[model samples]
Target chain A: MVHAEASTFAEGLSKKQVYEQVLGQAQALFDGQRNWVCNLANASSLLYHAYHSLPSPSNAVNWAGFYVLDPKNPKQLILGPFHGQVACQTIAIGRGVCGTAVEKKTTQLVEDVERFPGHIACDGASKSEVVVPIFQDGRVVAIIDVDCAELSGFTVEDQVALEHVAELIAKSCDF
Target chain B: MVHAEASTFAEGLSKKQVYEQVLGQAQALFDGQRNWVCNLANASSLLYHAYHSLPSPSNAVNWAGFYVLDPKNPKQLILGPFHGQVACQTIAIGRGVCGTAVEKKTTQLVEDVERFPGHIACDGASKSEVVVPIFQDGRVVAIIDVDCAELSGFTVEDQVALEHVAELIAKSCDF
Candidate 1:
């Protein structure tokens, strides 16, 4: 019987502590589950709620989700599981932040989305964004995309933490 | 360029009017997209946020998502796009509300989840649930599952409206 617990960070926990807790919970949740759809669906939910459980900027996270390589069209990414307002359905490779992550095969952590050239605005309220590539067998299989409502909303620590999450998803799920 | 507008219902709109508005928006969103993942992802977001935009019992909706028939395992429903806390990864056919909808090829409108035989408590806070089957070629392909925090939170009108939504999805997306 799979059950989902409410993702509430303990009181007075530091940001790093909160991330560590989220990472631990994610590992436990992914145990014995290799389905990409299921894993990504829960992953978005976990990240979205975890951010909201915090104060200020972190709580301003407007989106958390995944975009996977389209099976029919490898040059594009189709939206996967996500928690947010509705979003762009398909993004061609190298087109936007998500596309650039696929093109660069590395994490793109933009402090301000408006400053990024060719940034696709799916939600007008999103001010900053991060996209982490999830690799499988040396090829980018999917990307984790998070958007915040404030400028410079994510830190270097956030990039590092989410990279770890990317690696975890890469290893744990069969994309 | 695909854009996601904020799903804010106008003030004083009746529940039926809300569904009608949602259906119209969904049709417009699905106009050119055939990918099930993208459509379902947006569908869940639309339903979840639309409900939250309202007051009281409708606002109490905690989960709105899809359970797709697992291609790898034809007898089980794997988690798909969703907006909520983390959830169960899979449910066997006929085992739970979602699964039963698949097995029966009909909608399951449970006023109280606690009393449903073999109820799968993915989220303990869920008091009521409605599962509507999405059919393709006269066979069930996926299901729309919505969970509410209050007993009898869904009405017959909701069921009818969602059935129309299901038909729209069936015709619009490629499963």
Candidate 2:
């Protein structure tokens, strides 16, 4: 991290640097703020601003937001706070990219959404995608979904870092 | 156009058809709802859903949202309701793609964000972008910013149609 301004990151930060900055921001945003909606809103905002500033391919993240499992329907996920265009309102547990993350209880880094069978096209411009499940009390509560325009846009590092963010949210927020 | 289910459009609707459908939905969503935040929120959602369900290539829209002129700071554009990841909250006029649109008070369609000088990267995945200014009494009030992952994602028809939507919004909403 060639230190630039503290508010705006120096251009050309490595992906690792960007993720580190994002994780730190996430911690600061969620600190002592157990309000789920506010935390998710700012977290998504922090991730967007962080990834938006990175260079080329690594910075190609188009969408980042959360989808919480509907308390009314254990088998369904509903739209929560997000930073992108409007998205699908409900997704079944076993359906689409977000649902699959919940069904599998793991991070999914999809290189091509068109190739993902049953993939929900919330933003057709989204070519590749990733979804990380957030768990609390040993059950899935919400998932973070990020989409990109290029195929194979997300790497394993992104999965790991975002999963770490998810873990943070799982521990920090009140659901 | 081939007739498909009413809920789902036929695969190859001309640009005209897509815009018409989008404009209709925009009208329905904004009807009698004058609140700016709610109106912007639903408008972005309507556009995202309309475009996301389209066929490939045309469906490649990545970001759809608004940047309203700040009431306190006349020279700034503040992030408004949107459907994608978090975004840069404040943009100075003439600084970035969104700001440039406001500065010029005209529609801007860029094939590549990387090439656009002083372009602020809100989402690294956005390769192509279009911004349309919303005018009230011959002054810019807000602008609609749409981004795509693919180069040249938007078309002239999108400009015309989205401009129409902006007109409707300017007329319908109390800003």
Candidate 3:
């Protein structure tokens, strides 16, 4: 495995590297990695898959995943994999980051984390965040999420990267 | 366009019927036919889509969209879809129907609702449910849910139907 400086991942990060890293991590974990559940839980599978497939590293801030617990209930959004600090659990359908994400049914790549309201502090240090809803049979079952320490963690490239992740999620669900 | 009694759907209800019904309903709300999202939210989507395409449904389930929500956060997965009647929005990573589903990372189709423990009561009326996870890339991002107001709302056909839906979701995601 290749070790990259956080700084190297910070500036001019290529999407390929991001995706490769995530794939590598997933492959390693899948190759009997320890406490697989620790990383696999909370949409980490989607996160690892999406993160590695991205084409631009600069867009890492926007990488994330959101899932649902009960779509018929409209009460919560499931937490998935992320690139930055974030809550590791459910979000109400009409409440904070998860709630707003559900309410809008659209992906939000927050540029400034401080300005956002009701931001869950899984990693209190995290600033920017991105969220995307997971739709089931026309209804949103969950969402894709991402968090970043940088204010401008998300960008068009990040959005594009997630779109690919979303597509990957959309395709690989054959259980 | 077609409103068949839920019971009628039980008797060889063609997957095409499910797809048509799902898309028809989605079109009523959204602007277009993004079959992948609308279909995969529930395992029925796969069954229905396959029915539409192959005129035959496969036996599969999609699980990934939903998660057990953190009560303190009250945002994400509290339980899995196709669950029994209980307050399941706050299930742990490996408890109850939701947790069991995540632990296995596969669809759990209960034949009898009364037999299952940790059943949530979003609708006590439902006797049977099918929960399928939706995947983006290789990770679970959402789940396809199917519930029968009666016992055994799902079948092998239903399983295939929902898996088709999961495929659509996987295709639509950003990964």
Candidate 4:
């Protein structure tokens, strides 16, 4: 059973503190569940609500979700679990921020999505975005994509925190 | 490209009208995407946000999501894409409302979840629930589950509309 308490962040915590709480809660949630479908579904919910519980710009997050590498198509990503508005269904390996993260095998943190070339506008309200590739056995399995309605919504600290999350997901789930 | 406009329901539209809009937008969203992962992900988002765009009790919905039949374990339903709080990872067929939908091959509409025997509490705030089975061939492929914060949150009208949505999903995507 997933407790509502798990998704509710305590008030007055710093962004880093909130993320630390999320990581701990996520670890506990994934203790015996290795299915990517279940894990990603819960992970997106946890992150989405956690951010909303925060103050200001963090609360401006418009989308937080996953796009997994299509098993039959090695070069394409299909939408996975998410907590947001309707989104793009498929994205190629080198098209948008999500694709660029996979192609580069590194996280792409764009302070302003409009400034980024070839940015796929899934949600017009999204002003900034971050994509973190999840790898397994030296191959990318999925990418975590988060978008916010405010410019420069994410900083280096967010990238570092989310990258840790990506690493945890890569190890905790079975693609 | 998925426009944010596809998710925002117009004000003062009746519940039936809202669902009609959702079904139309969902069809447009799934026009080219046949992958269940992508379709279900977007479908849940469309339902969740559409419900919230309504007024008062109708907006009390807390969860809208899918649970797919486990490929490896045919007797179980694994969590799929959703727009809600963290949820149960797996439910054996015939257990919860979702499982019962699969077991009985019919929709389960509970006025109050607390009164349902063997009800699964994924989100504590959820008071009423509805689960509609999505079928392909002669077997259940997935189930659409929605929860609301008020008792008797759904009516016969809701079940009828959602069943239509379920049938549309059954024909539009590949599991």
- In terms of DockQ, the best-performing candidate is 4
Where does model 3 exceed 4 Å of error? A1-13, A16-65, A71-73, A80-88, B1-175
- Choose 3 or 4, whichever is better by TM-score: 4
* lDDT per residue as tens, model 4, B1-175: 7787798888898888899999999999999878888899999999998889788677999989999998778999999999888888889999978988999999999999999989988778999999999989989999999999999988898899999999999999989
Worst 10 residues of 1 chain B by lDDT: B1-10
Candidate 3 vs. true structure, TM-score? 0.37
In candidate 1, how many Å is residue B24 off?
1.5
Tell how far residue A102 is off in model 4, in angstroms: 1.0
Specify the highest-TM-score model's number.
Answer: 4
The DockQ-based CAPRI class assigned to model 4 is medium
Per-residue lDDT tens digits for candidate 2, residues B45-151, read 66765677777555788668788887667988766666555555568999988989999889998888899999887667778988999998999999998888799
A79-147: candidate 1 lDDT, tens digit per residue: 999999888888999998999999999899899999898989988899999999999999999999999
User: In candidate 4 chain A, what residue range of length 10 has the lowest lDDT sum?
Assistant: A1-10
The A-chain TM-scores of all the candidates are: 0.96, 0.93, 0.61, 0.98
Q: Which model is ahead, 1 or 2, in terms of TM-score?
A: 1
Q: Give a tens-digit lDDT track for model 3, residues A1-175.
A: 1111111223344665665445444344333222211223323433533443444333344334345454334475543333222233345676656678778877777877667787655555556777665554655655666666567766776666565555444433421
Per-model tally of clashing residue pairs: 0, 10, 105, 0
Please give the distance, in angstroms, between residue B126's alpha carbon in candidate 3 and its true position after superposition: 46
DockQ of 1: 0.75
